[model samples]
Target: MTDTSRQFVLGKRPDGKPDRDTFELEKGDVPEPRHGEVLVRTCYLSVDPYMRGRMRDRDSYADPWDVGDRMGGHVVGEVVESEHDAWSVGEFVFGEGFWSEHSLLDGDDLTPVDPSLQNLSLPAYLGVLGMPGRTAYFGTLDVLEPDPGDTVAISGAAGAVGSTVGQIASLAGARVVGFAGSDEKVDYLEDDLGFDAGINYKTTENYRAALADAAPNGIDAYFDNVGGPISDAVFSQLNVDARVAICGQIALYNDEGVPTGPRKLPQLIAPRARVEGFLVGDYATRFEHANDRLREWVTNGDIEHRESIVEGFENAPDAFLGLFEGDNIGKQVVKVAEPSE
Candidate 1:
């Protein structure tokens, strides 16, 4: 195999909002596999909001990337060379290959994908059948346990995880309400995804009124993705014994310091609402269980997925910065080098 590579590097830490200046594109030598590693030709790279936190200078649950380090995330690709028998040449797999054209992944980092679905497209492995789907599954089923006839509300309802959460709640017999930024996104949620109601938060001045109009009985469960004023609004409306799952907080990721807001601890105390924070990585033990159920849902048409794919590895930084601008309708991915079969 020819030795060639392209990778995205953190150019500088963002002062407030991230721009293209925050990233740098570079060419590099394709890595060779070590004793327990395999060389993977990158197929598709996942560009998630969480990557924003990783770009920061402070410590997060995940390690922060230095100014010149290659940015890391999930990728689905094919093994072209291997030093480990568990992954052989021509096999499709998911690995932490990042924004590079090629990567030497450790044995434990790769998960083999069924080649029978190769023509179905492997990028789906980075979205619905992978991490985001599992985030929705384990977060809702395990933490929320939404009951039949319950009204479930999801903020950031148009993104990958939020969209899946709404559909899963609907599948489990709950009345679903989705909050998104645009009429187009809200419309898709209501018309296609089967959410009972969709609110365009960008256009609405009174979010509480809109939420109340949609869920007359108050919210029984809330899957919060963007935490800020929206979460505070939802917090004040929880029904007794309501369950709230704290997922991603895109609204707070770029903030300069502790965000100030109206105190809402009273609402939780009054209703006995259970608000729990979860990191999807912590649920790895049951990933197979969640993956199987998500695959079954996809096969049965019970779950739907969409992707906002950017064309090149060089475009990863812009694709990532586009998240805060609401440029992606679903999972944002950068397609690097095509995997060799």
Candidate 2:
């Protein structure tokens, strides 16, 4: 069926903080899928902090989005039409769902989402069960291997990956301490999520003091999400042989360049701490195991998650901007279209 849908095109590259002017929304005809491809009616589109890096014209671990190109993101959708046998019509799939109402994906690019979760919100595929979930899974268990009772500290605790990390760490028998931007987030981590300790870094004048107050035993494992003063504080408070999982540097994403924080490599060296950076995409082969475990946790009530669902595909640009400002409580997702039965 011929379809016309609205999609956001990157209007201009942002030098620093992105504004709505940076994106231009326009309507376009949904092109038919070629052989070995499927037409996915985009149900939900994810808005992640990582997408900010893509909008900038700079060198990074991931490629930048070209000018006038559709904003790239993860999306959960139904197979409206399929030219490939593997992807039948009405199949739920997750793949590169750009900021659009409908998307085309090669048979190789799409991964089938759990059919049981169809009745649930589609954004859950982009949040707890998707990249964010996988990131927290492997990043904690694999990258930051911690023993029972190890003191683990996580920054950006209110965010998708950070929230998942705290929950997983608590389940893994670690004394979890989380730092977030607001008092509400801190309350969410400590009261709602059962984190051992929570601190609002935005209120605290000294993060070092806050870390010391929360984690008296020193940090055994650090999940570095906001890489700024908070990171430096955690680095300084690391115990001997601590492991640091370098996730997204959300603090620096909107800046013109990497902000200069206190240099603390000496602290890492003295303690022989291992700091490792990770991307969930690198662990795609093992995602099944991670998802299986995450699914079990969710099923058993060991893990609880939230999603910031923004209605309308046109609101994608606003959702994307909200990430940097910490406006989203949990996983940020844009509802592109209703799921097709």
Per-residue lDDT over 165-227 for candidate 2, one digit per residue giving the tens place of the 0 to 100 score: 998888889999998878888888888899999988878998899789899999999998888
Give the clashing residue pairs of candidate 2, or none: none
Model 1: per-residue Cα lDDT over 255-318, one tens digit each: 8797888887888998999999999999989888888888888878898788888998778888
Q: How accurate is candidate 2 locally (lDDT)?
A: 0.87
* lDDT for 297 (candidate 2): 84
Q: 250, model 1: CA deviation in Å?
A: 0.5
Question: Residue 135 of candidate 1: its Cα lDDT?
Answer: 93
Instruction: Give the TM-score comparing model 2 with the true structure, all chains together.
Output: 0.96
- Score every model by TM-score: 0.97, 0.96
